[model samples]
Target: MFEDGQVVPRAVLDSLLCDAAISRYIFGPDSQLINIGRTERIYPDELRRAIIARDTHCQYPGCTAPPRLCEAHHTKHWGRDHGTTDATTGVLLCWHHHIHVHTHDIDITWKTHPTETSTEKHGKRSRKNAPTGHWEFTDRNGNLIQ
Candidate 1:
């Protein structure tokens, strides 16, 4: 049921569950209603910030939309794949690309790089390396996007 109390189909509910705030309902004995908790964000602030820092911009190929204009997208969907809501499984995508990805069923594969310590002699920073992780996009047909 919606806030307007209009009953909808399960498909509508499933779609909302995929990328919406969720409220965990607690129960009591005798199946009595107990508590209705506040809705929780799909991606928490810290994890979202980490993903934004790592991505820096939209991960959809040449798109350069900054983190401010992007949203955290789950490479492995939480509802579909039971994916974890962590930096390792998230990426930054602009609104257009984010919607495009989900609409067209684009696949995202995340590859992680090990943390490398600087080998500099003094306290100077070393040359910057790749990000902690990266993602590759593929179409539904399994063809990689350039």
Candidate 2:
């Protein structure tokens, strides 16, 4: 049951109960309950915003997609430690590129280059390349160009 202002669709509520029943069958009677007393919150909104501002767009090299289409990915997995969840340790990437970054064992290099002159403004960092030889840009037929 929910408060007056809170609403849940009947279909969604039914699906949740169905899922709980399946989980109980697989993991025993206690599986449907959550033990949250020791859980820690990671990726607070401040950190998320910082990550968005720093990356500005997808971190995959040559990917022109903007941050609005991207997700914040921790360089180190969140399950490993809290340090990995910091905004400075994360990168923004679009869904397709995010999968490539995590699942393909691709190597990505991030670096900062200095500005030529102070009046020229501070130089921003960038991703140098994608580990695979495929170019980010391709022809209509999807052939990579040298």
Candidate 3:
């Protein structure tokens, strides 16, 4: 699932999906999140793996919640900001911190690749978010969250 590593077994990826570790996320060369059709709040499989790979644990900085328990959270609320279901717009947050993030107005910023070109067709429902590369956290005041 990574750009510079050995291929993850499809079985592992399937298991992660069953465990709900995959959420809205990234993808590899054969496919990209920018090319998937998104349903209202449901993540396509590729997106899910991308998120699981991006965050091996709850992405709340100090939280150690396992990936299987995390749900995809939009750094920008989907309804409120028209957030896309892509890694650049998503973060993995466990149940507790997920609630906290929303209530506290924390901000998650992802590093992205705006110039990367892809041959896949962009989904009509997909937001035009740049593909996420890496990420950082911040608070409402723009100070680092951790």
Listed in order, each prediction's TM-score against the native is: 0.63, 0.46, 0.59
- How many collisions per candidate? 0, 0, 3
Model 3 regions lying over 4 Å from their true place: 1-39, 111-134
The runs of at least 3 residues in candidate 2 whose Cα sits more than 4 Å from the true structure, single-residue gaps closed, are: 1-42, 80-83, 118-146
**Predicted model with the maximum lDDT:** 1
| Candidate 1: clashing pairs of residues | none
Sort by lDDT, best first: 1, 3, 2
Q: All candidates' lDDT scores?
A: 0.71, 0.47, 0.64
Error of 2 at 122 (Å): 21
TM match of model 1 to true structure? 0.63
Q: Across residues 8-74, which tens digit of lDDT does each residue of candidate 1 receive?
A: 6644443355577754444456553333233333766655766777789999998999888988877
lDDT digits (tens) for residues 37-91 of candidate 2: 1132234455556777777778676776887787766554443332234444556
